[model samples]
Target chain A: MNIMTPTPPSKGRVDVDNFALSYDTLEGPVEAVSNASIHVNPGEFVSIVGPSGCGKSTLLNAVAGFLKPTRGGVTVDGEPIDGPGADRGMVFQQYSLFPWKTVKGNVEFGLKMKHLDKSSRDRAARTLLGLAGLTAFENKYPDSLSGGMKQRVGIVRALATGPKVLLLDEPFGALDAQTRVIMQQILTNMWQRLKISVLFVTHDIDEAIFLSDRVYCMTARPGSIKAEITIPLERPRHQSMMMSSEFLGLRRGLMSLIREESIKAMGGELNDLALDGLSIDLHGQSLADVL
Target chain B: MKVETFALRREQQTATGPEIGAETSHVRTVQSPAGAPPQLAAYLRRWLALNRRGLRAVLIGAISLALFLLAWHLLTENRVVFFIRFTNVPSPSAVYESLTRAMQDSTFFTHVVLSCRRILFGFSLAALIAVPLGLVMGRFRVAHEILFPVMEVLRPIPAIAWVPMAIMLWPTNEQSIIYITFLGSFFPILVNTLHGMSLVDPVLVRAAQCLGAREVSIFREVYFPASLPHIFTGLTVGMGVAWVSLIAAEMISGQFGIGYFTWEAYSLVQYADIALGMICIGVLGLGSSALIRGLGRLVMPWNRT
Candidate 1:
């Protein structure tokens, strides 16, 4: 929160070209991402969606510079991905908060990394926590937090750094369905206010279409972008749009892309959450903010 | 059935031997069966597990002392095992008298103070240096590679073996004792600290790092707290090793410590006095270790689990 010396204005234009990653296990090399090209504009909320084991998370990881691509890699703004640094803040699926640090402490950790004074950090942390409705839980540890609360803490921690882009890897995957919807709405609300580039990965297509400017569908095994569907739904996406036919049709289209990938990739795993019945609730957010 | 399933069945069949035997034994012992006693035993087992090695050791000491006293009284009275000068060895009452006498000696307290000062000095120094250094090595693989090899080469060398070097390097004889004690406990604390540092979750580190913290800041903020449980462990272990090496250090370096006093008693063939001194050392070491463990509990309450 105490970013006293702001970084010389961040460009926030994140781009990936021919991004590839593989892990050479004893069995053989498992190619996680392959020749994946995507661009997230300055303030675009783009979500990458695919079936399980489709390397959507790997794509997010490559953007975060956690994994170096064997062939081509990612570039944030203009700089080449070297090592994991503060320029791209990542929200891990596990809500990887330092269990010892409290919620505010975790949120303020990145700010402190910027070497801001304790007081400034505290103030900024409070503001961010307030935005996420986590101000009351500033001093609570992640272990004490519910799955949704921890994800909120995770988001605050990522956002606290004031990084150019926020990279999320299935952040709400572990939450209950009800909590997931609430968290998604909270995230979208925060994203609307922040206006920062977000590269979110999820297995849920409805979530992808509901929250993104564009949704990138990935292929399995040697993962590459299978399709990029521009979400035509107007923003700020209200709760009403979730019930609208246009939103449902857009959701169906994204699901179809994922279903095709799922059939080929997740051969045996049951797909119980059918396309026809699944619903999205954008919470009570109105059309005033997203645009 | 198939041979594979038949073999599996046979293995499973033999697994119930202990339970079956216990059941049969219970049947023979009691006219009727009740589950109460076994359940009570399980509760008692869990209770003991919660108390740990210190409590177990204390119980053993009490039992051994009781048995030893009972045997001493019996043997001396009946002359069951005729003594080669039972007077010199002393009976339980005589030993008590000797203990009192030793306590009354002004020189005895001096020895204790001197030994304690040496131990505190040596162990504290070891802890202060090893904790930070080990933390550095543990947190970074590069640091681990750079520093661990030298530490490994030095770790196997006994603390007592440093006596000659300590004496030569330091001007004062007391300095030698402190050095010896420091070296004795250094590696255990270092190793444990390193273990504590090394085992801190990488996710936690990254979580901190990606927030905007520099690499150095990550080590300071994340690695330090995460490594505390291990660091405290190292402190406890280092204290233990330091105590073990303290006597050797005192004997070599002190003109007036517990070790020297014990040695003097031995040279004079005062076996009963020597035994008393040995008991005092055991009591002192046990007390100090308990203190460290208590301190650990205060600082890292999470470890109690």
Candidate 2:
């Protein structure tokens, strides 16, 4: 994955070109992301892995059209994204399902918004909920469900409108490890079945490596794309693949990438610390010096 | 042979094992008797569980009323040191007798009906106007800025203070009393509805927008439902205030109503009728508030869990 080589953009591909986003605070304009660029081809699964405060979420928000980039633009399917559109759906980490709506009602929401009649809305909700194995709990409120179940409903609700791209901001970040793994499998299955583009944001290195076609590592604030690594694993990934050598290699690579950014962000001297058989330092030089 | 048969049955039961297990773990199911139909027994169990709480509440309430009655009897019987304020207050039995006598009088029905009508009309008018205004004020900054300061100034002036203005504004005494009642209830409902609308989760709004909901739909689906619990709180508080204003207005401008009856009784020095009037107002207020709470629970099923 060469940083200099641009991904071949196609129709329905999400492209962020030289994207820089900032927030206007009382103190000053604080830079969140700077000159960050990434692209996801149609039906490709991409994950952005970074340290805390690396602006991974800010970048994803820019894609979701919740926030406008200060410098660059985000284009989806060859069109500039002006605001939140139905074609780009989002799943949040907090399982932002409307608590007032039942599981079926939450899933039916997009269709209802699309002005689909009651029967078709019910059919669509039933189909999606059944696919997610949430049929039994259709009438249950979100507060009564497990965190994993709620997140599944969140996913279905996002997918209910049949969006072209799914922007997931740490969708499984709040789940327990076991549930997180199960949810990952469920997501993988859904993505495979639907063939939708995904731009997942996460701090978990293993999650990024396990779920993504390519993992993009981001530096700390003012954040920029640091590296991109291709995942050579085959699709329809299994839980057992986590123990394989290639998976472990990718995991180790992403962990170190995140660690370097985290230390640099902390203003740590980055003097040679004991790591996995590698001595690296970024004392006075830039992130590229060590990479 | 018997053991083999048992194992065969177990295997048959578990043929749909994984799916059944998943379903059971995911859905909270109540266990019921296997052979017999559990509908009757289930209904009975639920009914009993529900009424167990109700029964406890009723028992405690009855005991409390009895204690109050006994204390009232003792105090007015002129037997207690605390009762010796050269007591002119009527005894509990005397009040009870007056209540019975009033129940027999047809004028009592007129008084009760008139008071209830005024409360219902005034409260409905207040809610009709305030709820939409509050929602608009809360959603838009400019509307809030223009209206909130005015509301703050008006909210402090007690409903009793509005009686003179209401009398001057309306031609009839009935209209004036209703106006005063409306003024009393409008602020609580308005303030509460605004609070609820403002406190709606920003995350939910963003999620709704991303899910293809337009602004109008978002307000209808997300903001409206989100504000319901708070609206119910406002309704309950507003109902109470409506009753207070109604009584004050009725007392000030009299023809009929429990408030007028109570004031008339006080002037006539019939302390027993005064006590009865107070009791009637208390009972009606308690009932209405309870009804509002029940409605709130019905509307918000998620809040129950």
Candidate 3:
């Protein structure tokens, strides 16, 4: 992928090569992401899934140019990322919509920054808001919206700028399970319509498999890419696909990979010694048996 | 799992169907009706229901105040002298009579107006200077570092303590009084503005950046509006302090103001007038603080409820 392909010039190709990041703490320097490399082809949806504190968000932030990589670099369409720009849009898990601005105002923020005229900004905001089923709430402040609605607005606000790449950092993580599933559907629908490359980060295995064409599984802290698994599931995927044998197989594989890394991340905190007390309290029978 | 699928299906139906428009129109019709008299009645009912708790609170406050006034009337009218003497204090009726007399006198309005002018000038000047300075200090580390030490050193000194310096520094007594009032309100506004800036969520800033906001736009669009509620908090507090400092300054150095009127009454041994002046000061202070809260509500519509 690093080799300059003479193929047609397609935009939104993200490339992170051997990216590493570290930050200083009172005790010492802490390594966050270590030599992690990943890519999302133009117009493709990709996700990064890993155990907690696995630096998946760190990698995403670096790509967004909020933080600089300590080792290698991040590039989109062969141009190195110097800082955050209009070319990339990001949706945060916290639904960081400006409370002071109404829903339409929040969505039109990027357009305002671009100096788009009033009529165009309004038109663009309304169209995108309509797609997200938030047209009714365009005049309301973000504080009045539900969690799902707020994240949907977050996505709409990010997309309003007409960016080539969309970056989402656990966008549905704070939502309930049902909202999460519905949000995934809405996100995929938006992705298909916009035809923008996406780099998504989440800890949910089912979410990763459902949303991405390729999923990058990262190891625990001082995180590095452990595997890059491809999902052969057809497009226009549905909630029912989750029960399909193919989907379950992919889920099982990703789960085991993540489970191993999660246990390792706990660092002997969940070893046999921890279970020794449980067995003893249950009168020499397993806890499940006693129950 | 079944529930998840059911919810997802329902959401998809809502997303694609004409249900959204119908739902919105349904909400709109419920919120407002077209019939004039019926709508007015419904509005009145809703308003009454909403303010029922507030009405109870106001009733309680009024009763408490009336009881306190009754106690004052009893103590002074009877000239009670147990542990504390009420012999020299004027009764509430005497104070009310004095207040009625003062209201008829044109010079009493002059005293009230003069004092109001001083407060307005001083508090406005303080807010004008402090709000911007606080924003700058909060946003920039270098500004904070340079100004913080100086502010800390100066803040501990009460506004009353500045009266001597203010009188010496300014040519006119009016300017000196205003200066004292300014000093009283400035620090709270500045400190609270700084606090408001710090309290802004960093995630919002990053979100703005990703949305392609430049530095100036970020500060204007995000920082300024985000810190407004805090700035209003400062303004409300500063208004109270402004009144306190203004009264003290007037009493010490003024020839014609409410504070001076109260002092002159004390010197003249018109005990009833003294109580009248005290009541006047209390009413003015309460009114000004209420004005600040009203302005806060006006500016921050999102903060309502």
Candidate 4:
């Protein structure tokens, strides 16, 4: 179900050192995450899973330098994060591909920002597009592509900058189930090839387990890490492997952690899918993509 | 809950339905075309079916226009309309003859070229100023705060009302007319461009930033293009306004141009020349608007696909 390949030399190591984030809403100061520490080793794939309002995305945003930490700090390769930079590439849950640009243009945007010459930028963009099976659609706009295709382009665009770390915030949440699976496979393939550090934020336990070497489960509002579960499943994951005993055990472990936190956060607001707790009966139920 | 079950079942059906429908459609499409002419006929049938609504709309529009023209002809030529009497209005045939005669006249060409030059100059000048101003105002709160109030005050005033002010403000009558045209188009273009820039998705901005674009780069790559569709909307609207105001200005202030020609014809009581002038303005307006639309299509390649 999984195949481990020889790892490439690790280039990016992300360290979230007791990071905390808060927002000043109309109501007052609201803490989103507090004292959340996580380490992604070089070439490691780590997923942060949590309930609604659990600030998993907040952590990812902090790492991406989109939000300032309230307490501790995030660093990439020993450099303290300040603002957004090309060193950390992020793919949002929303397909953020520039509508005006062709697929190639969007992909080459990062390269252009780095002041890469025209020929090299084109070569790099063409290479990534080919990697995503979108070389033929280079001239097409983002609007013309399917949701999955757009997200794939999003990933390639992030990768084109040759960033040391790739940050994903529920990248497949918008896609259909079949397409989601396909994208997961494509992402896994790309991750294996590039061997860049990945900090994935997702709500789906299965997706977290499927994609990451370790999964960090966060508590609800005033969010912080509740549990860190190591996914012992081998690399190069296949869709069929999701049904395996190891995968199910890991999913069940993560599910109970999330259910407990969600029940506390919502207080009987948990629907049947959430109420099902750790059962596999909720498979294909189309639960909320967020939270 | 029952709702969850229902939703899951519906999703399953929709998911499976497309696969089955696609397979059958593929087979049917392959089997349907038999011979060359038959295949061509089938292709045309498909094309017609796809564009049936558009074709119907065109047909309806043509019929309405034809009916209106017929009514106009009957009313003016025979003076047979129930409530309205046609006294000064020329018959359609007389107007047509005048139109043909005007088309052959060198004076008509001079009038047309002069008016076009004035419009092109003013419109281009307005666009040159408005587009960047709008983008800046839309992008920066400080710029917006400073400009928004002034623009709002000016936006409601009619372009014709600017006639006296424009005349006093500019040295020559021609410059004043151009200024009036500029005033007519400027607000619409600026307002629409601002709206478009504001409507640009914040996610696109964030995505661009994450990809390491600085402020200028983000504006060039994201804000400018994102606002283009709205900008074109403004351009077309502004063009129409520019023409209307251009005519008014030309009639009031000029000795040549179509607007002056038409006003001169009306004063002389030559209804045929008046009709000819109206027709020329209408044709030119249509052509210019169509040109703007063509430019819009050229710039926004994403919209075409």
Could you give me the TM-score of model 3 versus the true structure?
A: 0.89
**Clashing residue pairs in candidate 1, if any?**
A110-B211, A113-B213
Off by over 4 Å in 4: A1-8, A268-291, B1-38
lDDT of 3 by residue, A1-291 (tens): 111122232889999999999999999999999889999999999999999999999999999999999899899999999988878999999999999999999999999998888888998889889989999999999889999999999999998888888999999999999999999999999888778899999999999999999999999989999999999999999999999999999999999999889988989677665645542466667768978
Model 1, span A1-291: residue lDDT tens: 333233343568888888888889999987887678999998889999887887888777777767788888588878898777887889988888887678888888877767788888889889888888888898777777798999998998888877888899889989998898888889888887777889999888778877999999898767899999898888878667788998899888877777788877856443554444334343666546533
Candidates, ranked, TM-score: 3, 4, 2, 1
lDDT of 4 by residue, A1-291 (tens): 011233344668999988888879999988888778999999999999999888888888888888989899788889999899888999998888888889999998988898888888888888788989998999999889999999999998988887888999999998888999889999999998988899999888888999899999999888989999998888667888999998998888889899889887786656666566753454565566322
Model 4 gets an lDDT of 0.87
Q: Pick the candidate with the highest DockQ.
A: 3
User: Quick one: best lDDT, which candidate?
Assistant: 3
Docking class of 2: medium
Per-residue lDDT of model 1, residues B1-305, tens digit only: 24445665655565545654465534743223222323556657877898889898999999998998898777765546454545455566765787889888898899889989999999999999999899778766798899889999999999999988988999999889888899998999999988887688888877776776677788778888889888888888888889778898777666877888788888888776777777788888899989988987786543445
- Tell me the lDDT of candidate 1: 0.81
Candidate 2 chain A weakest ten by summed lDDT: A1-10
Would you list the C-alpha lDDT of every candidate in the order shown?
0.81, 0.88, 0.91, 0.87
- What would the per-residue lDDT of candidate 4 be over residues B34-116, giving only the tens digit for each residue? 22223556657888999999999999999999998887788787766466668668888899998788888899899999899
TM-score of each: 0.74, 0.87, 0.89, 0.88
Clashing pairs in 4: none
Better candidate number, 2 or 4, judged by TM-score: 4
